[model samples]
Target: MLHIPTWKRIVIWGLVVLGLVFALPNAFYSRVETHNDAIQTIEMQGSTPELVADRAAWPDWAPATLVNLGLDLRGGAHLLAEVQVSDVYADRMDGMWPDVRDALRGARDRVGTVRRTDAEPGTLSVRISRPEGMEEALRLVRALAVPVATLTGAGASDLVVSGAGDTITVQLSEAEKVATDTRTMRQSVEIIRRRVDEVGTREPTIQRQGTDRILIQVPGIGSAAELKDLIGTTAQLTFNPVVGRTSDANTRPEPRQKVLPSLDEPGQFYIVESTPVVTGEELTDAQPAFDQNGRPAVNFRFNPSGARKFGDYTAENIGSPFAIVLDDEVISAPVIQSHIPGGSGIITGNFNIEESTNLAVLLRAGALPAEMTFLEERTIGPELGQDSIDAGRIACLVAFGAVLVFMGLSYGLFGMFANIALLLNVGLLFGLLSVIGATLTLPGIAGIVLTIGMAVDANVLIFERIREELKTAKGPARAIELGYERALSAIVDANITTFIVATILFTLGSGPVRGFSITLGLGILTSVFTAIFVTRIIIVMWFERRRPKTIEV
Candidate 1:
């Protein structure tokens, strides 16, 4: 009557074996990590003798999935940066200048000669020669305004156009500014994430904090300064028509033009158009390669729209030079030798292999929306993390030992079976975590210690019920069956309520809090399985072998 079917027993044992196998990689963390990294490198860059040796550190057939260590458990960099969202407003006004000029020129008969005037940042102003044409100029400029593309800003114009006397001023509306800030924050977060992920760091947290701030935590990085250098490079690339080359660093350029120093030559500057013919935003792919002269360079390709524009520009101006600018510096200025039809080009400079590779990585990750000012930075050392790990380990060991002794002393042989199930419960928890690639933090270890204490609750209930049943003069097999059946409701009720709380925590929390929820949620499932099925199966098997007339609780 108190027996499990042979097929059911086999299925349960099969799952236990599979879970433990998946969890085996965590026992040899460094070796499996090396093997995984080596395998990834071989796939990306091909294998060398050293890489081949590292790849063989772990067997090919074994599961290589590992539980990632969180930033608190590993040395890393942490930064809180405030995005300069106001910087984009000036660029937005600059972009709208051409449209404003063209609109005003369409009615030149009445507006007379139109000229741009110096205005404050985030605002554009233009002066007309004839004062009587102010109303016409304002009307023409206002026609360029479009509805803002946001839910709350629906039907509101993106630009506010106004005129006084002979001058007309244009600026972004308040609704549009709010929308722009949201977009800027989203783009900054995504770009930072891509830049960090390009270096293959594990479990980096790049999240938006408030209105214009971001929090970044990267594990296994050298320091905060190194991380800042990686993500801070704007990598803004543009191809502009070169106006003239100059040796004077203080040379002033005409309107809609800028002077930038050359990257390869010292004290040499080039004046180029302010507006670019093509930008890095249109780039589809970038890779490191060698030029025809065997020098390190980067090869980049543009999308279809960019390809068409580039081809037309090259075809029309076959002899003119175009400056390739990166972060406001002229990286290269090559004259068009012939009609270049394809959208692909090579960027050659005084670069070695490493610089070329880094350039390619940045280009592929795309440019940041705007600059960021680091407000706070901290570098966590590995020594602190090791101490935390040691403390957590000692706490877990103590909890484990105390639980095993208490269960063994209370329920005698049945209590020993409960201890065995508790061990299996922990193994299954780690196995699940490994399978899901969950990151472990200090709080997550606390959750595991809590799980160890809670894991024996079901066994206690079942044993007490068995004692009660034996006192009623029930047979041994009937008492065991009734004990498990009576305890099932209480076990499910208690674990289900706790699991709901864990789910809520996971849904609403971030960082270490989320890590704790992950372990707690998974521990509940594993504990339930071991308590209800595993320990019961072991007890039933023992009873079947012994066929004892009266069993002690």
Candidate 2:
């Protein structure tokens, strides 16, 4: 076990030196981080003298990555939101109304004139003028049903069509409901992530909690309320043809149209078509710009399909007024002066620079499919986070000191060798964590402290084995070799068992528990390398130099 070749010794020392070099940058984390940020800014924009000086403060070739502090370590916001998935089901059925009407209208002679009636939220109820043609009406509606493409309900149809008396009801099938819920949840997560990312904040945790809830954590945000405001908006935008303008708030709109209050003018309402010409889902880009009147406005461009539809609509309806609606309210009503075929348009609203900029961000991120209700919200203060970090640092230092003193006193020079390995073990841990940019939480600090003590256990076992070998009539060299060889099995068994436990904790735990498991697992790996491989190298080099015949254990 002590017969390490020259090549192996060189490789082992090389790794230790590399770990120390990587870990050294963390000792001056603030300066290194500032230098890294400066370099990134220079790369993105033209570099100034001040930025060049900041970049020169730290070497670019050195590892600049630092451990990411978690929300507990850095002040941030936490919010738990439950998505209203059933809302999508209702919206889905409502959207299908036009298709259903057109299909049933094709067979008007047999099914008779059909009129829609109010039913449950997710059910579409229609009354046929003729009761004798109910069977034919069922066949027509059934023909519209398409198979659901999901793992659980792959072969089943997406819609359920049932009829009783002259009334026919249409609703999503069981399989379709599951598929819709899954899709809604996925879209909600993606939209939320995009919206948060658009704010240009640092790393944010956006994870699905269960079937209906999402857990969001954003470090360095001011408060939960601020984060909620950023993502709470549905930002639904639409353009509809204006049927008429009205002064009365209670004025009734015509069929297939609705009354919405103007955002700029108070108490002014416009009756516009409920069905939109185009939705915000087609918008590809939006930026804040000045309008023809030099007013703050939002400029938007559409995707290919949206551009085609919008172009056709504007070309066909010249000189007619259309309303730019946002979140159910008409933001502006502008008359179409000429054919707009470019697919780009400007929205003039009563908006300041900030409002225009925010609106542009929302448009660029797209709209959420459904609304969300916040179940829990919290804001951690920076002062408290700093206190926790200070306490953790002190605890780690104290634990490290105690372990080093105990190991040095118990095993003499060999214990000192173990202590050197233990120190390097910590450096290696930090090096690995920095390389991966792992988030460090309060519990993670505790895991590191625990590892300090555990790291010395292997050294103690080996030292005791050497003492026993000394008493059994053996030379110093032979005793050292036998000591390491005999202790190898026990060291591997103990570390492997502890490693398995750490793996289990990581797999089953969440949040802070997961942070603890990460450090514990990584500490085990680094400690084993330093204790077994590193300490052996140091002892062998020392023994070879001294050539001691009578060694004192």
Q: Which candidate is the best by lDDT?
A: 1
**Which stretches in model 2 have alpha-carbon errors above 4 Å?**
1-7, 30-61, 108-120, 125-134, 151-156, 163-168, 197-211, 239-251, 260-270, 281-324, 329-365, 469-478, 543-550
Candidate 1's displacement at residue 282, Å, is: 2.7
* lDDT for each residue of candidate 2 in 1-553, tens digit (9 for 90 to 100): 3478999999999999888887888899778877977876675344899999999888888788787778888889999999999998887887777788888899999999988887888888888999899999999888989999887998999999999999999999999999999999998899899988776555688999889999999987899999999999889999999999998999987765899999999989999988788899899999989998899999999999889989999999999999999999999999999888888999988998778888998998888888999999999998988998999999999999998899878888888999999999999999888887788889999899989879988888888989999888468888998998899899999999999999999999888888899999999999989978999999999988898887866
The most accurate candidate by TM-score is: 1
lDDT, candidates in the order shown:
0.92, 0.89
